[model samples]
Target: MTAFRLEQALGHTFRDRDLLQLALTHRSFTSPHNERLEFLGDAILNAVIAHCLFERFPRLPEGDLSRLRANLVRQDSLHQLALALSLGDFLRLGEGEQKSGGQQRPSILADALEALFGALWLDAGFDVAGRVIVRVYAGVLDRLTSGQGIKDAKTRLQEYLQGARLALPQYSLAGTEGEAHAQQFRVACVIESLHLRTEGRGGSRRAAEQMAAERALESLESAHDFSRQPRS
Candidate 1:
């Protein structure tokens, strides 16, 4: 099943089979897993996505383009790409990682997808890699046009508060969940004047804060009154 999916995703069969094998290897499984490949692929992926956004949105400034690229290339986005390729099923995981569910981990899956791109680049060169990237990234790139605004969480939250003349929003960690390595953070966004509190959870502190801000935004937007409603 994985073999077929890989063939379809890559759109090329490897003459040097070890390259394909290396791409699928996880660090938890092998000493020389795909980290190096992931590093190289990360650079290429950034460049490719940057180029795409630049060409597609000529009027969009650098900051906006950067934001779009960030949204597109973030961990969640890459994990979705891995899912599309059925990449998790093909991962060569160590016994411990396998038992602990490495396949479903966002970082592992995202990194593995980048490593696979790096592997494709090595096996077939730039042209092949370009095709693979464009193919896999087309949908995500399309979504960027209709995706959330270019504003970051902090900026958006600030704008919402300033506009309403409400006290500024402050963020604090409510708590942490999961283990040290895979910790999940819960963040609280507080409006001091209104005593409004909104919480969000994510894999990291910043992400948790952003989620909280987004929730606050949604809640505020849904209600007509900015003070009584959720902060947008």
Candidate 2:
């Protein structure tokens, strides 16, 4: 798709044409790449999504809201949005990236989508970019609300890490407390790449693991940068 058509699809015309081009240009393409834009957009996207979830689901607790936001903003979700925009066709890639099919790569496409959001915010403001994000995610949000119960935290965490091609988190039995038959368990969830460790206490081993996973997921969503790939 041409840049003009992309603008039409995105529902925002850029005042700065160069910003739009920068957003679409991958690092491998040249200097002054989209990584910084991606970082800014990542923050804006998280804040916008958090606000949306908070307002849309008033009765939902913090953990559930975090889970929903994580699902919506994950690389796979952004990749789908990119594909819907026919975004790959418009990407400016280096020869190596182009030959390696970088346009279709989930990481690049997702980062580009975020960079586009960054561009939109710069061209206009949060109001415009937030609306476009909500619209782009409308179908996904609908499906999530249509009696799709919250996914298991452990499963959700695994999917999140896997989506970014990060190393799987390790869950270990830390210890136990209380007497026999009434003991509370402590589980530690560690993701080495992010240098993250979270602990959860529960009445059973599975419960403890799930709690740990939930905390870990929340930390990953709110604190860590999922855009970074682990070293080979």
| Maximum-TM-score candidate | 1
The list of candidate 2 runs beyond 4 A from truth reads: 146-232
Writing each residue's lDDT as its tens digit, candidate 1 over 1-232 gives 3566687766888777787888789878877788998998998888888888888888888878888888778886686577667787999999877755566566888999898888888888877887889899775555355335445556767877787777889899999766677676789999878667899766668767776886676667566544352434
| Candidate achieving the largest lDDT | 2
Give the per-residue lDDT digits (tens) of candidate 2, residues 118-162: 988998999999999888877556546622444566877887878
Task: Pull out the clashing pairs in model 2.
Answer: none
lDDT of 2 at 53: 80
Global local distance difference test of model 2: 0.81
Cα RMSD, model 2: 16.2
lDDT of 1: 0.76
